[model samples]
Target: MDKVFNAITTSGEEGVFQTELCKSFSLDSRDGSRLVGNLEKQSLITREKALYNGRWTYKLVVKKSIPVDAIEQKPIDLSSVEGAPCICCPSQHLCSIEDESNPISPAKCQIIEEWVTISFNKFMMIQQTEII
Candidate 1:
């Protein structure tokens, strides 16, 4: 399954025809169909109907790549967001997504928008510095 997925991934966005893929691996039609079907069922790949050399067949396209390493889980640091404008917002008590008449909603808050813009710029700068 991993080998099949690797082959499809290497094929890029154009993808590989199901018949050709099966042939490359010397897989019988029934087994090959089941293999690709399993991958499709797992959401690892998508099969699209296509006409290749005047013959109808399905093209196997990679949907998502499986990570080689397990991601490290770390506790989120809330201190990083201590300076958020909403933290000390005077109208934070009145803010509500459901209230259409609420004038202090986060969606329509200029202060929050400005804070986000500044924070995003700072974050980008930090990323660029790390890259350097």
Candidate 2:
């Protein structure tokens, strides 16, 4: 399942065809289909019907990434919004003027307001800290 998920994620938004997945994992059609069905049921991936090499098949796309690491990590403070745009935007690939989907450019994004406010607050905090 991990290998299958990896392959689909590696393909990115383009997704991986069921036939290709079966071939790569040396899995029979039934097994591959079953695995894909399970993953889809879990909302981990979506299997969309697509044309592959003039044949009909499903393209498996990752809906979300599951963190595999077990290491304990510090929680990031939400009050500090540094690098928020890059961290939050899902349509970075379509950010250019040529892309019609980009209704708000990064320079004009309302989402960045929180980030700017947080940054200003941090800067003020540093100034106060140094003055003391």
Candidate 3:
């Protein structure tokens, strides 16, 4: 099972066809199907139906899992909002969502909108760089 799972994972995002995977392990069709079925039941892999060389087959792909420890270790980074307009605005104290009397509400603030747009673009660029 471990070997089968590792093989599927090593195959990467494109995944391996059911017949080919079975052939690689020298297992018969029944055994191979059963093995992959167990993996799918365990939520360790997913099978997609595909046409391989005009023959129907199942494509086995590994499920991506994020470690809980990694999520716990990563802290929320608020540096992106460092230069936001609201941070140093003199009327920040007067800004209110429910009060119609306040003219400095974030909902109608152009400066805040521009700042958010710029910050979002920067965040997207950083995300793309990290992915690369």
Best by the TM-score measure: 3
By TM-score, highest first, what's the ranking?
3, 1, 2
Please provide, for model 1 over 1-132, each residue's C-alpha lDDT reduced to its tens digit, 9 standing for 90 to 100: 899989999998889999999999999989999999999999988999999889998999988655657666687988567578887889988988898787779899999888888888898999999999
- The lDDT for every candidate, in the order shown, is 0.89, 0.84, 0.92
TM-score against truth, every candidate: 0.48, 0.48, 0.52
Over 4 Å off, model 1: 64-132
lDDT of 3 by residue, 40-126 (tens): 999999999999989999999999999887776767897866898887888888888998777879998998999989989998999
The runs of at least 3 residues in candidate 2 whose Cα sits more than 4 Å from the true structure, single-residue gaps closed, are 65-132
Total colliding residue pairs, candidate 2: 0
The collision pairs in model 2 are: none
lDDT of 1: 0.89
List residue ranges in candidate 3 displaced over 4 A.
Answer: 70-132
Task: Tell me the TM-score of model 2.
Answer: 0.48
